[model samples]
Target: MWAVSAKRESPPVPEPLAPLIDAHTHLDACGAETAADVTAIVDRAAAVGVQAVVTIADDLDAARWAARAADWDPRVYAAVALHPTRADALDDAAKAELEVLAARPRVVAVGETGMDMYWPGKLADCADPAVQREAFAWHIDLAKRVGKPLMIHNRDADDEVLDVLAAEGAPESVIFHCFSSDAAMARTCAANGWMVSLSGTVSFRNAHALREAAAVVPAELLLVETDAPFLTPHPFRGAPNESYCLPYTVRALADLLDRPAAELAEITTTNALRTYGIG
Candidate 1:
């Protein structure tokens, strides 16, 4: 594990001038089930320059909530899909609901959907390589049909994920959410014109590989996220994360890319907007 400089308590609220987009987040997981919760979260995010957020809902109920939230709040966008880990639990009805969700105006992408083999128990139920491949292929085709980018969530199953992506011919604007891949994978994704969305994990001192990968990716294909309510950046590693704390990860990315924090902010915000097809 790597450590970051000790966290000083956040200073007075910074001016909301920087243009930023948290391309991937779980606003629903931020405990926002009511209008008040939604207002509070969006207010906090807006106060810190998060002009927009693409919130993902991995299940049917959450997907409904996310779509409703997006409809209610202009700043929120939604991505609806069945996560690969939950593939075994998805039935025809769930797929039908996802298809319906995909057509909604504010639902911009197809996922936080992809492969994950991080936990043995979860994988046991979804472990069949064929099942994972089919699920990934289905999502890829859905994105193509809907003309939306696919937001990928990859864990220890990189090779298989990449293989499926290649075989299925992923959409041009795929976003590898919370991307923590190595330079080789980064280069491959870059070569294929996929966007890499960095999260708080990149701030860890031990994450030299992730930093190097971040540096090598083209600025046009780079993005930043908090993966909020999870993976809080170093120094605040143990704290629950929110959109307001995003600058900490942005600052870390600035260091990694050897660019001014503001410049990195501009570049990443632009990249995220393009990737998510937001204004």
Candidate 2:
């Protein structure tokens, strides 16, 4: 049996990198419960060179609040969607409202949507496979209708995710946020021109396969994110993560790919800009 330590405080932040952009995060989930919290969180992130973030929604209320948070800070943007596990919650009312939110000015993508088998058997909150597929399809169409990038969240259901994307024809831009699969899938996604966003999990001691994927990923297709308040990087694995803590993940990924941290910072920042369609 193995035991990872309980959460702890994060280590001191590394020296600033060139400006970075977080492709996916949940500032509200990270305890940023108010608009004021948004400013504070972005302030922490900016100090470490994270100039912007796309705070993603996992539920209907989150979608509503995510847009508001983006409006609260210039450095913030929003991605609105019903997360895969919450697919059942995508009732008609939710869909109608999400459409409105997705078309909002600072809402840059439709995402964190896809399949998840990990929570199916044991979790009461798990959405049915049929329902998840239905919601994912709707999200795909929503992305296309809005002409924004689609961000996918896949867990133990990569095949289904790809199948749906192929069936519906993916949007012009796609971001596989927190891409957890191995090098082979990474190559496949890259070949298809999908952006792969690596998160703090890549810094884990157990993530050799992820590191390998990052290594093989072309600079043009590679991206980075904090996915903060969870999956804090290697030495800070158990700590609560925030955008300010992103540099640690970049440093660890740089080591894995045998590239300089500053170099990874710049590459990912530029990748993020293109992915989010930011000017």
Candidate 3:
């Protein structure tokens, strides 16, 4: 569940930079319900140099839509999995369906599934921690079998997530989508060869730890995303987000790392292409 407030106008699109890829986003949540909407969204992103986007599925219908969306647009790819909060919904039927979706050529990853300790106790419908852990292992195995990266969504359960990854024998590739950890965790991720995908949150004024984490992340293990319809970058924190807004965060990271924005864009785009096994 997202804590959405009064709607603010979307931020002005930033100037185009070197070609980039949005390593994670949610097109369906960004109000893309049809092929035209998908094209328009990708077009907006492309105008700002976001050449490709990997939309993520948080539930069954979303999974179906994401897989289909990837086929609908040349610039779109997808990741399929139930969000950890919805781990309870991963019934046998859902598992079978997800496995099939995971194997789809356009579905680039098995993800948005790790742990969400922040909600299990606060939200009645949130899956139990045990259930979430079980589903996480299942998704990891599915990713392994599908031979795609395992995209993780961790919230307030860093240690638990790492424990599960160790026990489950992590897939060939792992991405900490929307990585919200500290420099220590960033170092750990780099040491273990796990990719860390930073979202717009890094540009927030109060995300000092996240910024520090970003600075320490090895370029080879770094990626970028929008996590659209949420976590809009600073100066537009309350506004709706879309893949097109990724440049703001990219520019912010460039300033933080004191590198040229185009260089960072190239680095992230190359990492994303390799991580998703797509062009």
Candidate 4:
């Protein structure tokens, strides 16, 4: 199952590694609409040793659906937050409801929040730096109040993201989801004891700097995710992604760090469980 067509189907499942967890994914964006769809997605992932996943919400509707999906499948956990690009939507009512969602038992973290300077000027509706920062700070506080890890979504605003955390005081547990920065940033995150979750983009041949960053990440602080329905790993880049494809990134990461695949699997799975407060 390691090889797959470039068509719209799920990328072929790679060889099963030791049990692993996808710390982030978008089940809804992957076209899952019901409990059965969630089962099918998780089942495919389980077949490849990705025994669990944290499906993240990027908006209100997705937040509701993510909580429901977590109930629908034991392997599914949820992290709810409005994306930084959509920070302007976090009005009073949204915040109230999001707080309730953030308190759910199966909701693992407050996340996919932080900065996205990549879109502000390029997209007219994208949240500017100030709006995104405000929303990020709010989510940070929410994570602290909820006593869960803060999951971050940083895009082309590394220094700004770090600056905001320093200014507002970060939560005890912080994770940089889809870490795309360089070795320096990786060292900084490691030094601060923040978790660094890498995605499929690390497998791209041209991602030399990302590979270097991966190499420097301490095993304990290292986590892995698919960020599926996007950032499919190399050889499968541009193909539709799903949780089952996570092993490809795990193997790629193992190669990048020159560790055994199973060892990397154990390290990342252990880190994921602790970071998300899951078993």
Best by lDDT: 3
Give per-residue CA lDDT, model 1, range 146-228, as digits (tens): 88889898887789898898898888669999998899889998898998999999999998888788878998998888787
Candidate 4 deviant stretches above 4 angstroms: 1-9
lDDT, candidate 4, residue 60?
Answer: 88
TM-score of 1: 0.91
Q: Is candidate 1 or candidate 4 better by TM-score?
A: 4
lDDT values for all models: 0.80, 0.87, 0.93, 0.91
lDDT of 3 at 175: 98
| Stronger candidate by lDDT (2 vs 4) | 4
| Model 3 spans > 4 angstroms off | none
lDDT rank, highest first?
3, 4, 2, 1
Indicate the TM-score of model 4: 0.96
Q: Could you tell me the TM-score of candidate 3?
A: 0.98
What's the candidate order when arranged by decreasing TM-score? 3, 4, 2, 1
Query: Can you write out model 2's per-residue Cα lDDT over 117-189, one digit (the tens) per residue?
Result: 7788768988998899999999999999999999999888888998999999999999999999888889989
Clashing pairs in 1: none
The reply for model 1, stretches above 4 Å from the true place, is: 1-17, 122-129
